[model samples]
Target: MASSNQQVPYGYEPPQSNVRGTLIYYDDFNDITDAALEQAAIVAEQMRFAKLVLYPLHEQTVRRISNEQVAPFYKREQRLQEWKLDSGRKSILVEGWDGKRKKYTPIEAAIRTCMDHYSSPYFLLMTPEMANRFASFATFEEWITKISLVLTRQPDHLHPRMETFRSRWRVAGEQRDKNGKQSEL
Candidate 1:
């Protein structure tokens, strides 16, 4: 470690991070395709995130949250692992908290855990359907201010809360121009 007394070269400065924050892909991963994975990776890279964390919900959690049935968690997680390896993305990480708990994990708990572990300014990458579902939850208002949302695409319909907090979210492939107008990337 460099001491406080250590002097830097006259024209040199310490390295600073160009990448910022974490992009968390929060989903069940039951119907995610390889193309979707690529889109997520592309988003993370484009946004210059420090990491891309795939937080797959457990089957019970999915059932509780969305009232949808899904395949076993292991199968889904293994598939994600395989994809990560095949894609050769060093910054991609598969979070296993829900898998290890083996129970219905609440969205609030999941988000809190992620916030505790990852860097600040978190952005949740989710499909439009999932984003709408999340907005319908009771804790949506509380969480919305804590982190931003990046939907996979523009939603055909929006939850009332989502509509109310429109500024807190953006479409994944859309970026703001110099004048603050959104344009497709």
Candidate 2:
């Protein structure tokens, strides 16, 4: 039997999207510079991600993960806002879900929330140290395969798991070899 196709109205075709995936910048934002934020945005644009989410970790979350002291969450968020305004980038988003909770938010929860709210193919952007700390988490192996890592820069040292999963990550602005050494692009 032949199937008949129904004609659709002009200009009413299904919506199409050129971009694919979300680039989530998850960090404490204590010492993040405007330059670093710009780099992340640039990376997102270059990769053609639909959105660049700046997911700032609350102070408690920072302490639990790395015992590092961070400025108040409000202050950090304000800084992010200022950068967003100055950069005038509409695709940038500063997520405050963790701040609203006012306590430590596990990596698992943070990633899950992002997954639920954002588009597929999530890529986590973080500093070298933060990436290492995330690798130490029990859920690292489970989540690593689900999402890719984008380190601000290659780390001087590597966590064992990071080493084992080296193929799962890359430097933001440059390419590197298997040993984490800079390689020609």
Best by TM-score: 1
lDDT of 1 by residue, 1-185 (tens): 87578677898978998899999999999999999999999999999999999999999999987899999999999999999999999999999999999999988888899999999889999888889889988889999999999999889999999989988898998997777567998
TM-score of each: 0.93, 0.86
lDDT of 2 by residue, 1-185 (tens): 99999899987878887788999999989897888888899899877899999999999998998888989999999999899999998899999999999999999999999999999999999889999999998889999999999888869999999999988898887767667675645
Clashes of 1: 0
* Alpha carbon lDDT of each predicted model: 0.92, 0.91
Clash-forming residue pairs, model 2: none
